[model samples]
Target: GGGSSSGGGGSSSGGGASAPAPGPQQPSRPAPGPAPAPAPAPAPAPSGNAAQVAISFAKAQLGESYILGGAGPNVWDCSGLVMMAYGAAGIDVGSHSVSSQYNTMQARGRLVPFSQRQAGDIIFWNDGSGFYHDAISLGGNTIIAAPKPGDVVKIQGLWGGSDIMPYVGRPG
Candidate 1:
């Protein structure tokens, strides 16, 4: 009688556990219905050659001097270079501020994980305090940037360390 009771107890417990699992799952299914509503907002896909257009524009500025707020035919700052580059491809990144550029891309769902960056993607840098700099990716591990004052826009290796943001803007 004791052996039969032990088997019955185990079966009841198993049944009770499975019953709760299905109960929780039913409630979870309805939650996903509303979750997908925001999906359409990010549906705008990148234009086929937009990345190449942006990258070419940035690369063409290789020898341009860096100016604090220059958006330029000549001088450029970090964000200025990025803004102008995307603008060339018909994408307006809102402002010339690095942080704002990042936010705009994020809000528009045009940001890509840093690990998945592609040519013309804008990479931002955080100098502990906040986002301070940005550059345009040239695919692989390279980027083109205006650098600092007195420096010209040039192609360089992608920066690493804690300063690099986790995502890069894909304005195309």
Candidate 2:
């Protein structure tokens, strides 16, 4: 006689069943803020030789979308950006990782100091962590970087963090 149509007098997990969710479910935490953006690609400051090709490439893609490993008219990563930029300028320099690019140029005495950074130079930063971040020094303390996902190629201060730049590897 006391039968009820509402769940047939049974409990429902939909706000009615009082069963807490499984194990220590941590409260929703926001994704950590993305690392600082990279500097913009600098204009040709030296002899203005073929460096303008890189400058033109970077300038043309000022707002292109940035995907971690993307390399195209739509998306690009830090290294991919550099590879494409120089490639557009007819330079054959190509590197997959930030460190590899750095090492490759380092062995050739292309690495330069931040003070001597010129347009088209590749800057790599190690935040004391194992991973590294990179950007193209467009001179004037501005660098071109593809940052992380959801971030497009943009210009920001050369340094992403407290790292004042320990070294820079110039891409010829």
| Highest-TM-score candidate | 1
lDDT of 2 at 1: 85
- Per-residue lDDT, model 1, residue 134, is 92
The lowest-lDDT stretch of 10 consecutive residues in candidate 2 is 41-50
* Model 1 TM-score, all chains together: 0.72
Clashes of 2: 6
What tens-digit string does per-residue lDDT give for candidate 2 at 50-164?
Answer: 5668867877888889887788878888888878887887765547677777676666666666777787677787766643678777787888788878888898876666654
Model 2: lDDT to the true structure: 0.72
Cα error of candidate 1 at position 88, Å = 1.0
Local accuracy by lDDT, each model: 0.83, 0.72
Question: Candidate 1 at 144: error in angstroms?
Answer: 0.4
List runs of model 2 lying over 4 Å from the truth: 1-47, 162-164
